[model samples]
Target: MAESRSCDEVLKAAFPSIVQKDEVQKEFSHFLVSKDLLPAITRYLHTQPGLHGRLTLLWAVDNRPTRNTYGLHYLFTLEPSHRWMLLSAELAGNDRLFPSITPHIHAAQWYEREIRDMFGLIPQGHPDLRRLVRHEHWPKGTHPLKKDFLWDHVLGRQQGEHHFRRIEGEGVFEVPVGPIHAGIIEPGHFRFSVAGEPIMQLELHHFWTHRGVEKLFEQQTLTAAVPLAERVSGDTTIGHSLAYCQAVESLLHLEVPRRGRYLRSLFLELERLHNHLGDVGAICNDTAYALPHAHCSRMKEQIMQLNDRLTGSRFLRGVTRVGGVAIDLTAAQLAEIVAEMDRIEQDFSELESIIAHNASLIDRLETTGVLTERTAWDHAVVGVVGRASGLDQDLRRDRPFAAYDELPVKVVNYRYGDVRARMRVRMDEIHESMRLVREVRLKIPQGPVAGEPSRVAQTGEWALSAVEGWRGEILYMVTAGENGTIQRCKVRDPSFVNWPAIQWAVIGNIIPDFPLINKSFNLSYAGNDL
Candidate 1:
């Protein structure tokens, strides 16, 4: 497995583009490199002929002692079997200026800005270096993730300084989208410079409901943080849970039971199957394809209902605790699940095939939101978006954690990087998830599901845990040896990396089609807001 390669080997293979490489600590490989080399390094790994840089996750950490953001860490997981390495590059704090990986690795844009916004570390030459998940009136230098940023002082943060930016051109009319929109979804503002519907420039502002999730998690205990993590994004409970649990497991060195491991994978795929169905249906609904949209939404509801019946929560919350799975499956339920999956898979396949062949449906999605392979990698897309764009970097198959390590799993990849390609990947993955579910159900072992977590975590140690979430790789890095609670925690959603790639897709497209393209990516606003 490429997961087995040492930090030394990874460094040696991709040495020229890399400036400084070494192990930061066990399980976390760290690299210090020139800022100018980042875009080149992004291309070296993420968009190379083969998968050299399969972006795992990119997040910035606030070093408590220094009271400043220490490093902008980008984890690029490598393709195993091939003689390649995933670049884990970090641009240091003092020399905060870094080149835009957006030009080379499309997914890195938002990550760079998120780091830019939260840490105040600017990506010097970035192309659309706009503020994300930060308010327009929130004061210039008040980065929330910093140690000194006090929420209690919110009422007195010096709000008004005439913060105005220009969208000037000869005939360039300004279009202001919402901090509050017509839809009931969360609020975000989009300012576009347009000449007749063709987008001349676009600016996205994303801090409508900030919620302060990272800071909130810092205040709560491990068990208490579970609910916050579960609520980080409404639908990604399992994904966030798995990432957090893996972090705890590494901390305590707990070996989850075979049964618990299988159950974990089962619940995760269940998460994937349902979300992808809902998202795919949503994309069609945006395209005005009612029949398929209705059918797919109904089918998706069935998937969620299955989770409610089995896990006792519609979104599968609390089923996964720190050490292992909180709920165990019975043999009879497993058999029934296998039987039900067999039928559900067939129904979905038929409905999807009908939708795929419809002429109007094809016309709507054939070339819309075209994110090329080069852009997809540069932006460090994950899950459906990355897979569809031919990035082919799935954490499950590559890293093989939990029950997935024992099973035969394939990462479905599509090359065109358009709306149809994104939809097709989600469709194929639904089938693959179904097959895995059946196999896991049959192989369900008899054992205890939960492990008792240790009362105290050892001090001053660092650990990283990664799980292949339905969306993409979910990363959780921790450090807490000095105190009773977490000293520093960095949470990264795939959208942190993927959201900026949409900027490229929106360029030159009709304004109305932007929604279609955006839905195809279907990035989590809630996840990004945190």
Candidate 2:
């Protein structure tokens, strides 16, 4: 295991080209390896015992203007140690090619394709190099994320249909659903190949709502990027904003006030509370049980009202800033929040009991949309989806960000890996979040909510922030440009990772059950599309 080996020992064994090891943040270790060794090192880290072989993120940075090279970063976390190891490689000149890790690591599939679509960096051995982020109408050879590409440039649309893979067999038929759904949900195309009632294969197509968020980040000032980050995903405002703020704070070496940390945690838990409450109810709604679903909506609405009372926004936007929070909670507001927590908990308990005693709802959820533990790991699923599938990894407890470091988190996990299991995880999490909010309110310190923003250092530095959002782990990687401006910001929403698992989960289930299975996961289309 990488945990037992010292940094020097691991470096000596791996023989990386350039190593930057820091002791202050034991969770991080950076290495610059040659492009040729990239795949081998990645495979080694993933296959080795005690390392847990989890690939957290794979992203590319366009450094052609400054460094005359495109840099690739592979972020991995070793279990038990909770340490992050980054393997980086540079593709110089016109030979922008690197071996694809997807063949060995299934989770790297979409990432590799995304690099091909956005940066024009070819993953040489990638099995399927079709466009991932860019739509079929997008002009060929137009890589939007490249340094030479204009942020606001518009391209003429080309008319063509995306070719989805077809399954050939007796009694096999295809059903295509929504790039535009009947509901007000975001756009995503799902092609399901079915044999009678059972799904044979499912192919998903997203990026319909791709808004050039990363390109927009390149245009914003360091301080001005927080609000933009908050808007990355409407449901995950706190998660994305907090992750961005933490990354900037890490780069500037700024310490948030103790009270501010608690407040941030409080906001995070509140965000989790409403989201989980709504998801639990939505799962019940999928079973045609409207009572629990309506009750869940009511509870969620109450939480949002509380959020509006505490922060200025219903979704808790604009509350997070670089170095600390934008606002502090008054004593009266804190007391009200505590009282709200009690009511929410009590109400949630009653609603949970009602859903649990419903045999029909249980039948609809249990043994349906089962995402096995193996499938979950292969896709690198996270959050409630990953927890329900028996993956014992949670960033809050494993990485310990914000007030989570001071307050213990009770991670809820289930081995069933079904819709019921996923709902149960959310049910347990709601209580856990309520308990955390109470703890934060009782122990919150008295101090200023925010610290002065530190002057941007001219040095080019990179930092990573991971937040355990309600859906899953939200990761942000930021690199400082000249004069402390952001050179590049890579956002990895949990939905981006968990969406792939849905295809596998729906394999044995009937077509009608697809909606129920999909709701069980409840991924964010906007977040994934971004």
The global C-alpha lDDT for each of the candidates, from Candidate 1 onward, is 0.74, 0.88
Q: Give candidate 2's root-mean-square deviation (CA, Å).
A: 1.7
Error of 2 at 125 (Å): 0.9
Q: Name the TM-score of candidate 2.
A: 0.97
Model 2 misplaced stretches (Cα beyond 4 Å): 1-11, 14-26
Candidate 2 residue-wise lDDT, 250-330, digit = tens: 888788898999999999999999999999888888778999989999999999998897777999999999989988888
Candidate 2 lDDT (Cα, 0 to 1): 0.88
lDDT of 1 by residue, 247-359 (tens): 76776667788888899999998899889888888888888877777888888888888888888899999888877888887887787777777878888889978886888
TM-score for all models, in order of appearance: 0.86, 0.97
RMSD of each: 3.9, 1.7
Q: Residue 184, candidate 1: how far off, in angstroms?
A: 3.6
